[model samples]
Target: MPIANQNLFNQSRSFYLVSILELWQRFSYYGLQCILPLYFVWQLELTLADAFRLFSTYVALAFGFISVGRWLGEQILGIKRTLLLGSLLMMAGYVLLVLSTHKNGLIYFGLATISVGNGLFKTNPVALLSDIYNRTRFTLYHTLACLGSITAIILTPWVAHHYDWNIAFSLGVFGMFLVIIHLIFGKHYLNQYGTLTDQQPVSLKVGLLVSAIITAAIVFSSFLLHHQTAAPWILVVLFIANILFYWQKLINLKSAMRRKMMIVFILLLMVFVFFTLYLQIPTSLNFFAIHHVSHQVMGISFLPEQFQALNPIWIVITAPMLAALYNRLGNYLPIPHKLAIGMVLCSSSFLVLPWGATFSDSSGFISAHWLILSYALHSIGHPSISALGLIIVNRMVPAELKNFTTSMCFFTFAAAALTAGKVATQTIAPLYANSPYISLALYSEWFMKIGIVTAVIAVLMVISAPLIHRVMQSNQP
Candidate 1:
């Protein structure tokens, strides 16, 4: 009984940490993504095309740096130093952003800080979570991270309303500071951070080359786009380097997956598709809330800016309940069923988005009460999906390759987040030019098309659910 209680206590502690840290991280990250476009367009008077490009670039950079951080941390730097360095960079970024008066230079400093800081924080957090939990408890613990993400969404609007965006961002810095406390005290729990003794670390020169390549690509891309100062074959070189990195990995692939490795590869690929869909909450839903919804209320409205908060809020509320349901049904249903449910819930939210769009063009600066209702539902759908994803990734992976494995999963998420913004940037531009906002009609058609496709995918997943279940059971040692 005491052993069970200790297990429960550790689980509880781990969950609380994951939820809270992610809550802070997302609160900062999403808030900027939510606010930056309007800030540029409204405050700086930049054109939508310019603002959208800058925002997409920044988001993509964040994703790119995450891969950098994960690779460096796992290879050369220990997770401890990597996390601490990340926090310092993030805090520095936020500080510069808050003080940034000029429109041009301010964004640069902020990006520099955020891009690096996130590389540090985002890569290690999941690895840390995996270190804390066993196979069965994986779902509940990861649900905490998902819940943290959800909670960030729920409170962002409220915080943005009550305080300036700068003030709200400082809260994230505070969260980073809070992580130092745990890092100091809970160092023992971070067993999953180091590389396995049997495996050799990648060479440092190759690592530096990879870093230099990423940095140069980002620089050339930004300069060429922003300044229209194209240098010769910059992208060609970067592309070749990236291709080479992967080609090298391909050569090493035979040795990479000596253990239960196919699951990581498969899950990474599958999740890239899955997250590409879910990560749209920040990008596509932005226009959906601003234009399609019917009403607005309080400081919170169903504006595109406000919609990002919903997924986070709903996750906080629903995660515990969903975790409970999964635990109860664990005996009866397999993990794949839970994943199927999550997929259905995600696609269903899009179906509902179109319905809400039909009621009003909240795009024309009308109220957002009805739109918020739609957002509330969207938020609720995410936790189950996220929790189950944790179960799938963590359970299928062996302990020795935790960070490397989790890095692949992180790449999926990073790729998805970047893709969401990129797709939104491209798709929303034409709509904005034609309609001035995401018109109710346009919004409806968009969601309907997406919903139909997602629904079909969900159906296929449902059919395959049993196969995954059998796989999990068969693989269980």
Candidate 2:
């Protein structure tokens, strides 16, 4: 058996290189996201629903196509080339976004490029790191990603407000350029992780042919699905396909494996609900904060995007404590039970928003503390569900199928993004259109409804914990 390597904690040079590169990539991505919603609504003149739909689609496809990127890296471009391509494509996407300030048709095309580029770039570095260290440093990667997001949320909006939107986006483009330069210089560290001689390789001709066909198909689909109304149906079709594919995979497992797979499936459902609720942070929740929350907190005026920093800042501050708690509680509680607690906390986060909304004064400015508290609640739940979900996937899935299973797990998030978009369209879009400047009462009602529905999901997760525990016991490693 190959011995497991554990050098990640040692802070090796290669590790720092990859981590820094990954951090910059995340910085560029989230920096844009910090301003993307307002850009769509304010600059593009899109309705709330349309903006959210496009955002949802962008997020869904960015993550959903990671599997495709992995395949292309392994089979055709190799990891180094794929990474290079991703950086270029993402930079191009940012440039197009800036140009979209003038020409609108470039918006979707830009989003599509960024989505594909992110998928290709994000995970491959981790894969290389895994090969180098002989272990996965998922948490470290996640922490850095969150830190990047925090920095972006704190700075990007301030830049856009003080300077210009194009300048803010140009900053993102510059970051990507730095990433490309770093990767090109430091790429030798990743050479050993590239396609191996033992692995079956695709012919270049065949790979190019396949890529062309896929591109053609995507173009045709975009043409057909040009209407905003058609976006949800596309998501529905994709969701159904993912479900059917997962079911087919489950059929071939032995009885024990099947039970474990079922538990994984159940856990994935809980996570889907969690993400559906959590994503409001970037979409509807941010809008609410900008419109309703007091700009002056303790007599200091802050940008709306800075509000997003709360959740990540909380996560960073509390992560070590949470890690220690997890270690102390190791196997004392079932994973399902721990996840149930997370779901409950997530539900409570939403539930708290309504109460916060109640604090709005006659001028419609509510204390930012309520939103801060909501973010804190969400930060607690975020790791509980997300981190544990990944750990559970690694532990429960069969060795040979781990990568495939993990891809499918990410697919759940894509579905959740789409679902969240649909929810926003139904709940938030109408309110924004009717009120233009939303009232405290409408905000409270909207928060209450989502909170109630999410609470029901939390309840379901709690009730199912025992059953999942029972199945999990039979498949314990």
Candidate 3:
């Protein structure tokens, strides 16, 4: 009984410590992201297309490499050293970004460093957290991290708009160092956890060779795409590779696990589509808000970047209401059907954007009300797709493949980030570039096309929901 109590105390202590570190880390990351597109266009003097591609690549790479980082943490550096290295690398990246205000090469190098660092920092800490706490306590970590991201999005633009870019990047540097300080003091608690004995530690020679190859690859890719549009193609190739890999995995698994995995994959693809539309908040929609939406609400001036907060803000507000609503509905509304309903809601939000676009004035500045409604709809619709997707994936994935499946789930976000970037550049950016403010007709037309596609996807999801429910029911132990 005493031993169990000690274990619980250890877990509670480490979870709080880890949560703080994770929160600040996300704050640093999202702070950079909230203003990254604007920085590229306004400061770096890049075209909208170039800016979108670069931002997409950065976000995609940052997320996509998390699986690799997890493997490295477990196999090469172990949990403790990997976390330390990742924090230092992140700090270095921010320093380089701060320097990029004076020079361009620093920008890419800094981004690459941050990409690798974030990939490492993001996953390894979760592993450590899991070591201390059971699945039920996991939500606390995610919820806190979400709050950090939300806070960053809200505050970063305010800082950057009021101050300067260097100060903004410096905020990230400060946050990264805080993570280091917290870990340094708290390592004793975490050190007793998350050891993998089967995997051999990476040797110095192998590490050097791998580092050289990665550095060379980064340099080559940067040089190759320095003056071109390769981001979309890269994402497409990755999606295809993922599809093939999953297909092979499906063939190898037992029938019950295989069916469940296949359903999860389908659901993930739908999520990819949903985010391709949803994540535009940070890229295309952000630019749209800045250029075309009115800055004043009831005669009060506001920064354009502040609108990005609507997503997370609304999520926090509406998620409980949604959970309550779903609970009231009970088992009558199965998970798959609820997911389908969410997809439909998401599609409706896109459609709402185009409808609101028609109300823009001659100045092409739409009322803040329209953007507000669109965001509100998105807030409601997003949980249906994203939050539900996470829940369903958790329930569906077999125990043995949980980690790998979860890693694949992260990959979906990476793919969505890349897809969102492509959609923003190819579909949305062109309409806004030629005019001082994008016209109401242009806005309507642009979103109308996207709305139609998502609507079709939603309808398909509705059709399949029952079958998915049946499969899940049959497959359960």
Candidate 4:
């Protein structure tokens, strides 16, 4: 091969390795996610409020600890080793999940372990890819993640139904095992990359400090999972602390960089809002599907978890087209405008649910088509905001701070997950005590209120797009 061609091939090879790892990692993660609430409700016999609280806390901590993971990768282990360590930890977590089928207390520990491992594993690969490639690959990578999610959403539930939850959880164990095996075999391709910390010698003090921090984080995560009521206060404190930390950091940057960082913070807030709405999928929406939506479509029975597949399935269909359109439009469209469009779609998704409720049959069960439509809109809206938000933050931050900034993006997600949990616990869970028909009406009303609020936000975002766009285009630091 020509020199340029060989380099391109090698880069592509490395990208594929990272992307595939993401694919399987998401497979494992989403597989567990799809079943977790159900597991808490049915297997562990928790109330809806408690279930959502645990689920949200687990999710919040998973993303929350990404900052710690990035620190480890940057300051101690280097990205490659950190990634390996995380995968191994995730495998252990999954193993504990399988064991939890017999010993219920093990589930909290299992979830805590997975959360920490996810924190470590999530951002490093993207950081590694950003180091090697200049072009934005967020859409492509997210599509791969969606693919993994779709497969997991479909299969995990089926496995749990046909076989057992232990076997289903074991699928995650197998997925992580594959991730570890692939990482080991593929390390050579990535050796030239993610080595920023490899040359630095770790002192015993630093190593011990890092270990202590990780242990404390795990313990805190497990505590939150077990003690659901404490989550709200803890999340609020974390959220405020994150904002203050970023605010202080933002003011210290050069003028142009400061402006860009300001926009990044704005976008992150938007992400928090977006995910707070989107996360209803695995919690309230899943419950809605099980209780209110018709399970039979064309004489075929579908599991509630299987319906979660619709979002990813829609993404798989729409992502390439959206990517192509974005490429074709080039700089004509700004990121803020795209995000505004997403917010509009998200609002519309919920708005349609209330309208769809009117068409319910005598049994108070709505057609699955309503959910299909809702998910379609939700999926299309995701890449516009979440994927672009990541790309924007990655582009705006200083090189040294890239991993940390990326982790901060995940931190917004963490806050959003916590908020979503609160929403579920406070809003949706209470409706569960009502009859299904009354709950359906109340759910629609709540959905309408959310839709209206998001619609208002979308309008504001649209109005602000030009200003944000101009700021983004101003002089670089």
Candidate 5:
């Protein structure tokens, strides 16, 4: 048997070498996200509606690519080749981004390229880590991954707000070059983690059908919900077809007969609901921050994307403390209790942001400090949910199917972004059109309303928490 790598804590080794390499990739990814809106509006001169819609589409499409990636990793390419090609594609993407920004239509094209690269690259990194560590140690690996995300969130906005957006994007180009180096040298560190789930062969036709069907469902879901938009007729038809295909599989699979699969599928659906609300932080909140809040600190105006930086900042400061607290509380405090508390914390953050929105007069802007607090509270709320989520999914799924299941978890995230786009069209768009200045107050009211909804989700989760815990624990050896 091949010797397992030594423990990271005991040895001078860490997943950090890999984490640092991964960090640069995220630096590029989040850095681009930070500047995308400004580039669209300030540089590309899109209307706020146009910019928001387009931005929403870019993000929706980004996560959507992961399903494509998951397939290739399993069937045709395998994770190693897929991840390498993805890394190179991302580098070329950054290069193309620089090249694309100068030409019309090219920026979206460039983002699509980068998003595809991420679909290809992002999934495998954690899968690689899984190959190295056990469930308990995987917590530490996840912490490292979370750390990278936090670093990107804080730094991306700071780079953009401090410098020009193009310069911010240029930093991505540099980050990608670094990724090329890391992937080349880190071959020895990574090659051991061979593709675990690639053994279950899936055909290209099946994969393509899956993609086509999912696309159709999203479209049909939008239509069934009475969302009025300019989507073409052909597109709508396809959307319906895709929904039917998935619905049939869901019914036929009798996943309940497979206990673990049923629980996972349900959890994924709940996560979808969570993501719909959460994804709004990027798209809808962008406008909410730009228009509603009052602010000035040392003459710097806080932007919406900057709000996203808040959660990560919280994670960096609070994760270790929370980890420590969990250790101290272990064997006494119930996991459900901890989770419920976190969910309440999450809802209140939104509640606070809306309060700030309402407080701002049509002409009177609110201070950035309000936003800062909102973000901080959100930061606290996130790690609580995230830590629990990973634990549940990892422990419950069959060992061999972990990659596919994890991809489903992220798929919820992507689905949420897509749902948020639709929600944006429903809530924010109409409110803005009807009320205009009055919409600010309406949104504040809406934020508070959403908080109630989130609190309910938290409450429901709390009530069900013991049951979930029991189900998860019983499934394990």
Candidate 6:
């Protein structure tokens, strides 16, 4: 092969490897996520409030550590080694979870391990990919991640139902084991990328730094797990710290890059909002489905957790089409415009739920179709904002800042997860306890309020599109 062709092949090959690793990683992560709420409620016998608090704290810490992971990948272990370390840790975490069946206290330790592992694993792949390919390819990668999520969502529930929770948790261990194996074998293909930090010898000082950070993360995460109320306040502190860090970075950038970074900051705030709403799927929405939505469809009864698969299933179907459409349109549809549309779609998804509730049968169970439709809308809205925001942030920043900015994006998600947890605790949990008979009605009312708020934000985004677009495009050749 010619040099150019060989390089192209290598790039595509490396991308495929990274995407597959992401698939398996998400498989473990989402599989665990789908079962966690139910596990908290049923097996652990926790109240809804406590469950949401724990769930949110686990999620928050998981994404929160991405910054530390990015630093590890960039300054200490380098990408490949860090990825391997993370996978191994995640596998161990799952093992602990499996053992939790015997001693329930193990679950907290297990969750903390997974949170740190996920922090280390999640951002590095996208950072590696940005080096190999342009933004256009990211949507396909997102689809792969969604594919993993849907697979886990469908399988975990069935496994837990028929077999045991330990076995289901073991599936995560299996998934991470695949990731570790794949990374070891696939390291050869990625030798040309993400290796800068690996070239340096690990001095004792640097080694100690890495150790200290990792130890701190695990300790702090455990603290948050035990003191769930502290999670939100800590999120506030982290949010402020993030803003300060970005503000410093913004002033240092060149004119065009500065404008782009500004846009990234704005869009990240939107990301927080979008994900805060999106995460309701696993938390509040899951509970709602369990309590009010009929599980039967066409004479088949589905697990509540299985319904979570619908979002990813819709993504699997829609992502390719949307990618093609975006390519066809080129610059005609700007990022802000797409984000606005996404917000609107997300709003509609929630708005429909209230209306759907009114159609419930005598048992107070709404049709499963309503949940399906809501997920469809939510899934369609996802790529427009979530995936696109990632692409934009990666593309806009300088190469040196790519991993940091990517980690920052995950930080927003971390904050949003905590916010979503708080929302569920405040909005959904209270209704369940205080108004048992009108719980569904109250849930619908909260959903309606969220929908209205999101719709307003979408309109504001639409109005701001021109300025954001101009700022983004200015000083470009």
lDDT of each structure?
A: 0.58, 0.76, 0.77, 0.84, 0.64, 0.85
| Candidate number that wins on lDDT, 2 or 6 | 6
What are the models' TM-scores? 0.73, 0.90, 0.87, 0.92, 0.78, 0.91
lDDT tens digits by residue: candidate 5, 401-468: 67656756665565566566666544454523654556566567767877898888888877887776
Tens-digit lDDT string for candidate 2 (1-477): 223333556655666667777878888898887678788888878888888887887777777777877876776667767777788878988888777774567767776777778877877887667765654455666677678778877888888899888888887788788889888897665545556621445578866875684475345334422554665577678678877888898898887888898888877887888888877888888888888888777889898778988888888877767777877887787788888888888778877877876666877777988888888888888888988887788888888778777777778888898888877665464434545335556667778888888788778878888887787677344
Clashing pairs in 5: 213-242, 216-239, 293-366, 294-365, 294-366, 294-367, 295-366
Each model's RMSD to truth, in Å?
A: 6.1, 3.3, 3.5, 2.9, 5.9, 3.0
Alpha-carbon runs more than 4 Å astray in model 6: 1-13, 102-104, 200-205, 248-262, 394-407, 427-437
**Residue pairs in clash, model 4:** none
What TM-score would you give candidate 4 relative to the actual structure? Answer: 0.92
lDDT (C-alpha) at residue 341 in model 2 = 84
Order of models, best lDDT first: 6, 4, 3, 2, 5, 1
lDDT of 4 by residue, 62-118 (tens): 888888888788778899888888998899999999987556578888899999999
Candidate 3 TM-score versus the reference: 0.87
lDDT of 5 at 171: 75
Clashes in model 3: which pairs? none
lDDT of 1: 0.58
Q: Which is superior by lDDT, 3 or 6?
A: 6
Clashes of each: 14, 0, 0, 0, 7, 0
lDDT of 1 by residue, 1-477 (tens): 011113355655544555456555665676566667666666678765566556655654566567667765666565555666676667767777777764566657566667767876675766655555554655455555555455554555556667676665666566566666666575554433444521344467865874575466445444643542122233235434644553454454444332235544544555655666665655566655555444346654343565566655566567667777867887687776766676676677778766654454334443465455555555555655555676676776556555555555554565565455455554454534566344555556766777787678778778977766666655334
lDDT of 4 at 132: 63
- Residues 162-236, model 3: lDDT tens digits: 899888889899889899999899776665576572235678897796577446644644442353366556756
Which 10-residue window in model 1 sums to the lowest lDDT? 227-236
